[model samples]
Target: MKLANVQQPIRLGAMTLPNRIIMGSMHVGLEKLPNGVERLADFYAERASGGAGLIVTGGAAVLPEGGMGEVYCNVFLDEHIEQLRIITEKVHQQKGKIALQLFHAGRYAYKEVTGLDPVAPSPLQAPINRTQPRELDEAGIERTIAAFASGAVRAQKAGFDAVEIMGSEGYLINQFLSPVTNQRQDEWGGDFGRRTRFGVEVAKRVREAVGRDFPVLFRMSGLDLIPDSTTIEETLQFARMLEEAGVDALNIGIGWHESKVPTISMMVPRGAYVWVAQQVKEAVHIPVIASNRINDIRHAEEILQAGRCDLVSLARPFLADPQIVAKSVQGRFDEVNTCIACNQACLDHIFDGKVASCLVNPMVGREVEWALAQATVRKKVAVVGAGPAGLEAARVLAERGHEVVLFEKQERIGGQLNYARQVPGKAEFNETLRYYQTQLVKLGVEVRLGTEASADELVREGFAEVVIATGVVPRRPEIAGQEMPHVVMYNEVFEHKVKVASKVVIVGAGGIACDLSHLLVHDEVISPEAAEYLLAYRILDAKALHKLQTGKRKVFMLRRGKHVGTGLGKTTRWATLAYLKQNGVEMLTEIEYKRIAEEGVYITRNGEEQVIPADTVIIAAGATPNDALYHALAGRIPVHLIGGAKEAGELDAKRAILEGAQVGRAI
Candidate 1:
């Protein structure tokens, strides 16, 4: 209950920390300029004011080739010191300490971004990177070591409290640490000691540059969680060597985020890596910090109580709400904007060289310039539709001291968000629901359930402003025999999540249809593992129900679009593709669906007719926006559309909520 209160301030070498919470370094890849670094003053100053005891900024490029995404990354140069100094001064003024995380991406570098071929410990390419990296030789390795030291010296000069060496996440250091990637037989390979040489040398040189009293925290991965990667035992031994090599602390992160399950990269169950932190904490006398999917403070408290690690380092969660620390300290944990971990804005946007943005918190990286105010005159505001946009608008207007009323046709507050939570690995979506519910109630918005608003009601209430968040409705396609009992809309499949028949065909390549395909293939009812699989699966299986189902599934994907897929983030889009491939989903991309008959689906492939057998056809192609209210009231009253009603986005609650909030504040 008293996690931070019980903490005695720990020392980070010469600098002292206020508490055990370390804002760990995570690259949203949101640097705005060719410089590829976030502005030090705006970002660090925001975190400092948000009560970050020690702010560890995102990883900065140490060299030109390692520059990722866009500009604003603090490149280690003399000219940047004045800017960094101004940032450090702002943080210090707010009574916060700061650190710089330095790194060279190496094989993690991309040909598209870097222009030059990537360089790795060996020729073995990192899984996510399409770029085949050139192997680093002795000279290249030495240059990298010097680059890290130079970054540390720059941090020291820029008035950073400390410098963190990022030797984890399968970067250059981990590549060398693993036999899977480190094929070199020379001085830097063949064994753990040799593999750790580059990292240890970097730490030593950085420590030497920053001096003995300066802190050097090594952010590392205890286990790569990939085949032929370093195991926990080997990583523990490596941790000891780092402590011996003069690292003041170890920030333990897990799994090569790029190769393994990307949802694990963002949305694994909370505390997925606490055990890794616990193991390292037991192995090292120095303070230990645990990261990776650590958004829940209750989970953080439990980990600390069990002595898993000395500190909780939040990445996505901090970005979701910078005021987490102050709110948690004030017992207003409910007010904290919880990260839904959708990765829609952060990772996906980064691929486009855009600044980091949170699904739930629209003001995340752009906070310094974004704000809103209450109404100058407290007028009545009516929000039609109790979905994300409606809730956000009502909450904003009410908070600004206006009378607000919210109406939903459903019995609950959440709109499409209600169904989004039904998907596997998407239970975290409820965080947005909790956020809006708390804010709406506290802000004095009158919420009415099961109330469908007619245009006349608005005029009766004399509302000065009306926001219609009328959402989308699933449109029944004009396909012949659609009324056949077997043909179902994408929403029905997702809502019921029941598996029928051994072989099925999903007729839509978009995200919703894709989600249904995954559920049917992976769930037990459809692709049971003896078998066990996706969602409502075990409900039908009465016997031979095993504990875990690792078996893959077989299904079919029918797409009519010329490009196959559109409007999805790359990593997520890739993930769905990989799953379909891994699960043996036969995809008929760019195929036209002629009709669904008794036995199978008739289609056209490359102007030729083809038939695919299926026991069930799941329709996932499109939805109709349920905007009768908006249409009827459009010119007479003010109305704004959000989510699918506005456009076909990935049906993310965070985006909906933020859009709603944005509109609400504007109103």
Candidate 2:
């Protein structure tokens, strides 16, 4: 697809962006001080130099009470201007414009972190981050408005080209806009105008603070997907009101923490929310920026060419490849590292109170540390296994001017990813593999397919360094009757190496077990080719695909732990569990496995023995490090263990890829 419109310049208020692409704000939690200055500047500067037209820093707390649970920038004080100035200067040096997203966490703010009870439009608590928020009185509402205005002035003084008000994501302004959270009968909550007054007032106050010449962007939810929240029509009316309130531009955001709709997950199709931005763009004269799940240049171009929005905002895509825009402009889109929207590293890290990183790009939050330098001494390196870890190690070493050879026992690359791509809703996993394949070919790394080099052979080959990333092997628990013909491993089912019956019992409730249950219970076959075909044509939607289960088989997932899917990422766990329940997949947690029988499986739950009838038994009981080769080569040659071979605790792509990059750079 031609990206003529996507590469065109756009004007937003008083600012003329070099291109139509904007780096959407995402919390990285990289601040080192309350005044919000330090390595965070380095992070933004890298993206700026990489060719983003405009960079929007993550939300900075507008008030002391609005402090997020994690470390975030604070723009409420005068001292913050100096530190913020450092960031603006760095971006300016690259001729890139920047904006600060001013936010108030509202009820989402943790009392433990802020040392203050959260305040909302009403006393209603948020569904996700449950907190008993105190109702904001009239004076408190006025104070919040003033705080937003003050934050804008601070941003202006810091030399930002524009400032964006965080009126989306169920924050303070959004709390007042949504009827579900705003139950008060006061001036701020009774009618539509009353409910939207908080956002309108903040926009007006910010415009007054920054003056008409300075740009002011307001981020608004085009559709509050949560129940009892604002509708699309209401959102359009709100957009018009915001424009009248002096908002220079509108950024359309979708869903919330409490919304049932999938916003940023891999299950959601690309450009799914472009229609939301289209409605808002038609409702108001101000330019609109569309965000969420726009991954590749083709998708971004589709949204722009369709006139859905004037500009496109990408968050995770920038994390995956900071040079995406530059690469696209230079007609090198194939070289771009496309974001798979796994949310494993970026969102999961933020929730864990750690700095956000990327699964594919290890240099995301650690740009300074992971920056590549020309190696003074190049050596011959051998990377065993072709998993994510091994591919990353080989790619980095080759980029550093080292002679590298990647060996895989299988005929093709992508060790575990090959199996993962067969599961339902996991077709996006192939993008990671595709990226590695492209990089290996581009770097001229010698690839040995179907060649399993033994320790002795590697030693004789005289490789200066060896990276053993053999990944993991399924763990077979010692249980009576496990050797029955009906028993099979999860991978065996995917590989078509085993026969199964209508009734199945899967041991373990981790990610693998859940995925297997989804695969077994669904009647429709979803091959990688079929999934890609459907996605390309937009023939199927996530909602329809989720409810397409015919329940041809009865599957039981048993877990010894108290909870199921503990290994699953927080963003996708709820939806997975809901899918299993809707499809009649029985989940039994806190069960002790007694034995596997040809006819069924026996287990003990709550100190009571029970027999679950099953025609076949599948083992999803985790995995173990395939470290025998590493041990065999240890000390014989310079052997380095990475990925699952180093430690088989959880199937974390983030840890695997990061470890690979670290080892490659160090070597």
Q: Could you tally the backbone clashes for each prediction?
A: 23, 0
What is candidate 1's lDDT per residue for 1-667, written digit by digit as tens?
4655324477877777877777878666545543323354666677778777778877777876765633546555777677567767878888888888897787888778667788888898777788888998789888888988888888888888898888888887878888888988899998888988988898888888888899999988877778878878889999999998898999986767566556343336777668888889999899999887877666677777778888888877778888787777677878888877767777777766666777777777565545566578888878887776677777777877889888887789887777767766668868778988899889888888988889988877788877878677876666777877777777666656555666677777777766666666665433433343433465544333432342344568877776444655665777666766766677788777788897878988989997788778777776776777777777777667765566545555556667777776776
Which sections of candidate 2 miss by over 4 Å?
A: 33-36, 69-71, 525-551
Tens digit of lDDT per residue, candidate 2, span 483-585?
A: 8888899879877898878999998888888888888877766655776777678887666554553557999999888888877888888888998888899
For candidate 2, the 10 contiguous residues with the lowest summed lDDT are 30-39
Candidate 1 local lDDT, residue 228:
76
